[model samples]
Target: MNISRRALCGAAVLAATDLLSFHVLATPSAPKIRVGILKFGTVNWELDTIKHHKFDLANGIDVEIVYFAGEDASNVAMLAGDLDIIVSDWLWVSRQRSQGADLTLAPYSTAVGAIMVKDDASIRAIPDLAGKKIGVTGGSLDKSWLLIQGLARRDHKMDLTRESEIVFGAPPLLSEKAVSGELDAVLNFWHFCARLEANGFRRLVGADDAAKALGASGPVSALGYVFHDKWANENPNVTMGFLQASGAAKKLLAQSDAEWQRLAPIVRAEGRELEVLRDRYRQGIPDRPIAEEEKDAAKLYAILAELGGEKLVGGAPQMAPGTFWALKT
Candidate 1:
């Protein structure tokens, strides 16, 4: 109890330093969220914006964006644990979950795509696409194609794959083929479809209408941010933080047309291409999802179930419950 003043001062300084160390350990840098994206994919624009704006950092997540040549490459990398998340459709998530992948889907963009036909082509409606040479992006498992087939079966009672000459090609190649009259019509992704429309190609049925054509009640999730359920459960903060960052990005894009100009260069869109891209991005921003028991959710589920039945989703019967993670809620 008779310590010298110098010794007392040293002890106080040591205690303060230890407390500072504890604070540093308690609050380390944000957790890194490794995300996979395809080169030239539309998701790239939002993600790149997130990086430039530091939205992920603001939301307490360190986001690392990884690029893949295609979805196949991304899928392989994700399964190998190199990726924490990827942008994909709900049906794809369901199919993967059905196969026991334990994946969860968060609404990314509802921008389902569209079919583009010539301004003067005989094609006028969905059924008009029958017996015509149609170009499709992705492979036989493309969601747009599968949805179209489902529409054909439900409305015209025809199997489009059997009726139409379906040709699978890359999005750019498909666009070229359609413009050069090599294909009568081309089913393209949202951004590509927008460009084709801007270039004077007629917009036929878009995926939203395609969903209506197949009897969906309300808005359906066309594409989403997908992650492993186990990983998400283990790192709840990272998952929630990611969704918050994404929501902020979506809000910015949804509200500001001027913001589209900022992303145009990154997406390589210009002139009419830029306008189309802006419109599609705005249109694809989805409302917060409702409960699974809601009528709209049920109807959306049914549409996907039929599309899945057509093998668009690797032959899953229906979307397994818990496939959709309403993290925003």
Candidate 2:
């Protein structure tokens, strides 16, 4: 992470490429690492930075980005061999691994939701949410809300579904409703949470806090770079080099405010919203060692499994082994 700027920024920035630009930076003979990503994914910021610095070529690989309009399509492309890598949660990776697919994950983000609300003395904690209307997305599939339920059950002896009104809607709509005072509290995606924070809504309890309270040793990375273990074993240099490139890009993004300037148009936010978004993204970067992540993930998986049953964790009693992929040192 402390790699020198001289090393990463030596190459002239290349023009942005939507589909494939491996040839732009790498020699024709270099290895091509095909990546599937959502068309509007935040992952593009890092990929753009990687291209700007020519990190992939410098690290001995070429990156070909294949954009999909939906996450499901991106995931399908990975399994169908149309992609070498895709961004997804480790739980999905675990499910695949259990079903005899050798998928693995490299930690990407721990960003989740929070109970956001206006300053009101009556709403101090989970108990205070009793009889209050809570706006949430993903209905029963909202992991942050599920974790909050686990936290409330463990700490406050309350069932959020029974005590509070759970209003399920799309994130933007739920956020809009929360602002109008119709919803007492809202739990939405992290970016929406950042916008809400910028607009003066405070965090009551974040998913990370709930995770910690539920026995996770550290923050759990809910999303990661997923790929097949077999392919990585066959292509060690590309695998390790890409991971290094990713780390370098994250380092640049974390330290350089100037870097965010070029990123602003893609971020499409102005003023406080932009600042808050940047800060929140910085907070979500994965810093823990893989052992800690795996340990914490196993713990959280059990919690989710107990609360959500087979639907949440598939049929596996424990997180399938090799859920977290580490570059062999």
Candidate 3:
């Protein structure tokens, strides 16, 4: 992560491709790495940064990004050899590995939600959320909400869904409803929560706190870079080079507001909106994969397992020791 700025900036920054540029060449002896990404997910920001800064070319990895409409489609494409790496959760990676689909995970991006409420709302703690209408996206099984549930049960002996009046809706609708006083509070996504924060919504609790209470070592990263282990073993240089480039991009974005401004138009954000995005994003940037040696990692796994049951996380009793890919190891 402490790599030279030149490695991140790359020599080809002068010839950096346009944001919409997708042209990539594959030599007879060197096949380009096919990276799959959701069109609007956080992964897009990182991939776009790599492309706009020419980091891929500088690292000698001929990269071609394949866009998918959603995670399900992206999973299909990865299995069909249409993608070498994809943005996904460690849970999915573990599930795939259990099904004999050799895969590995590396920390890439992390974002956590917040319980946003009116500035003067009386929702001071998790217990206050009880009996109040709360808007939630991703339904009852969203990872953040699940972590909150786990934390509540473990620390406060309260069942959120049973105690609170829960409403499920799209994120934009949830935000609007919360703003208009139609909903008492909104357990919204990080970006949306950031917007709400900028608009003066008070946070009752943060998903990061839930993650901590559930025993994560640091910021809980629900998302990561997943890649085929076979391909990586066969092309170690490309793998490490790609990760190095990614780390540099993370560093640059975390440290420079100018970098956020550069990509603002792409994200359709500016001013306070852009600042929130930048702040929330930098706050969740993960430094490494979870290690079993760490107590928090094991505790988090237990919490997720208890909350999600075997079905949600592919029935893994514990996070596989091989789930993480260490850049140095």
Candidate 4:
């Protein structure tokens, strides 16, 4: 039987539609990765500005940035399967790993912390802090704790836990307490440290000074960009894409101040002064992958091990294979 021209055209259209539908059904949708980050801090800068910009819409991968009040909250979320990755401190990762939670390092974000004191305070050095009330935010394996411990070891060889009167409080409250002279000193991240300095607080010692005192040649750094080992292994392409995007964002930030201006509000909220925020950015922000990051990670692991906190992985996790990612040549 001969077909009519109209019927032939209709049949062809139907066949085309069927083929398109089949293709659509056979192809998998892009995966969306949930990323938890600390709210409004250096890590926030890396996440909202760099990591968000990097992985949000590249290679069919979506990176959802979830802001948590602190590292403990972030860890809880990750453990609950709400987050595929966590860009946070290494100490937290070590603790989690010790608890049998599988996590791996992805990248190093920055290296900066300060020993802040009220401008009118008599305390000027580590030794002067004896019998003084220093504030620290506890839980989630705080880097500030490690900083204080390192300082105590170098200055007094006394245990921070037993020798110093360390008061535990939230980050904002700690900064406020230090400013009001309710607390003698605070070991705070850069953002808060900047605010304290702007409000007439003195930065008695900074990361650079600490590194110098410890006879370290490079920046006394902290780790960033952690990922769930299972999620990373299952989605290698997506994970690598996220890393690539983060590296790109870091490169962009390093190349321009305009990027920083655009991201300032996201970073410096919570009553933090803009000038102080800008100064903090200038003091020390790592914009690229550094070899020392691995060494920093190792040092952090050592500290935790000494504290009976967690055991360090001898080498980088198999998923990442290296401490940080490099662009494929």
Candidate 5:
């Protein structure tokens, strides 16, 4: 999941030609933007396209993409001024904001996490998870905490810290551990979860199921586009243009199966069918901007604060007023 910034930038240059054809050449007349993304999995359809310079050609803006191995690396790159934009989880953004990292939400990207058990495990529900060893990566930006929070809200305050033994490891290793029964449950993002179930592991809970259990309508955070505040301030026009182009891509992703198929191979090079990822994408992922992105971001901040992560700005991370970019009506 961790990638070098230099390698990602190289990938972006190659992707630009494949994605934008004639447009990338025209975009150099304008200022270029450099973006960083965390390489989390194989089916990074959105980020893959953006990283490859496909978006630059399509939007006529020269974009440079850098890949980090993990969100923490991407954050470090952003803090060190190596990247202008970062596409990461809301938790990373919230944690960064708490520590005084000036960043802005661009748009929501994904909406679900998968909770899986081994194929032979008798666990059928969240409550059945009592005393089981669960594997999750532990850190300030721990995504498992979000899943635990959702589970607690749904299953009558199940204390994850006490009820389940948590084993910390990187995501791929965690998935491997879960499959081998070294861990009873593992919480993961899209493709890993899908692969677990496809390989016969039982799904105890997913983002959508947890949302329904909590009587909520969506996942814990609206995953989406993010940018550094300083970068946006310095390159307002280019940033706005990037947002517009990203918004267009989001819309295009919704309307065109052909677009998905074309991009899927770039994302899943091992001949993984687009339909596998497409099903998960359609379930709860939001392609357009949402009024609740900031609200959900605030909620995530609150959860992190409760879990003793870090303090937000003004002692409480209030959603910055007018954070989202609205396309002209």
Candidate 6:
């Protein structure tokens, strides 16, 4: 071919490539999605993986991670149109819906707290928690605490909130108290529970156990990517792509030990602590179909609301319809 013809052909090929690739937008900016995450949250691991593996780019999106110090801050950002997504529990989502918010949840992790005890502690069952100092993480409104209360009431006909001396504090602070032998048992978040377990602390009860006892078919997902349903509906492709990237990241983390090694500092563990963290995180990945997940979530919500009153579920007597966002097939 002539030089002019060859140049024209190359230009055509480049144009075609740009058109075929969503990452290479016609505009100057990348297709970006802003996500609000808790500072030092477990969600960071998956977000980091998405960046490391270029999953976002592959899915035709770029993730801009916005960090918040607390769940309330994240929710505020999401509500103010400052963020496209945020990590929160579906129960919270249900509460928001009841309050006139259009939020919905996409599954992230089923990981929740457990009642952890130090080695050689005499506490063995629900009845044993009576009259003992229990460090409860995230205050009295915590789902794990409420579920444990349900477990105790059902299994032992006891009110743990009243029977036990409850000390509500942050997870790290509570974990520290439990370690220093100040608290008899600690009901803490999953990562803290895993760390305690790996460090020889025993699990007296898991949130999953509490959930099952309350009539859930199995483990219920506790945290997920929550966003406004209207926004998600308007940007279906971007929303689906971002969720797909998240799933890809989870699948990578689940299968690759090397990925765990890379995320060591993120999880802040070493030796056996790291191993337990890995196992628990893997165990928490939501494997049930969306319908089944919603069914279990609905069941657990009713049970918790009945057991915990309006505190656990707020004004929402039932899980709002369409609380779980199903990925478009």
Model 4 TM: 0.70
Question: Could you tell which candidate, 2 or 4, scores higher by lDDT?
Answer: 2
Q: Please report how far candidate 1 places residue 50 from its true position, in Å.
A: 1.0
Candidate with the larger lDDT of 1 and 2:
2
Over 4 Å off in model 1, which ranges?
A: 1-28, 290-315, 326-329
CA lDDT, every prediction? Answer: 0.72, 0.81, 0.73, 0.59, 0.58, 0.81
What's model 1's overall lDDT?
A: 0.72
Q: Report lDDT (Cα) of residue 289, candidate 5.
A: 26
Model 5: which residue pairs collide? Answer: 1-69, 2-69, 3-68, 3-69, 15-52, 16-52, 16-53, 109-223, 109-224
Candidate 2 residue spans exceeding 4 A from truth: 1-25, 120-122
Clashing pairs in 3: none
Q: Which stretches of candidate 3 lie over 4 Å from their true place?
A: 1-31, 288-295, 326-329
Candidate 3: 10-residue stretch with minimal lDDT: 5-14
Q: Please give, for residues 112-229, the per-residue lDDT of candidate 3 as tens digits.
A: 7888999988888888888999999877767778888887887889999899999999989999999999999999988889888878797888877898766666764667678887
lDDT, model 4: 0.59
Pairs of residues clashing in candidate 6: none
- For model 6 the TM-score comes to 0.89
lDDT of 2 by residue, 83-115 (tens): 999999877899899999989987877888899
Which ranges in model 4 have alpha carbons more than 4 Å from their true place? 1-30, 38-42, 50-55, 58-60, 139-141, 157-164, 207-217, 269-272, 282-284, 287-291, 307-329
Predicted structure 2, TM vs. truth = 0.89
Alpha-carbon deviation at 173 in model 4, angstroms: 1.3
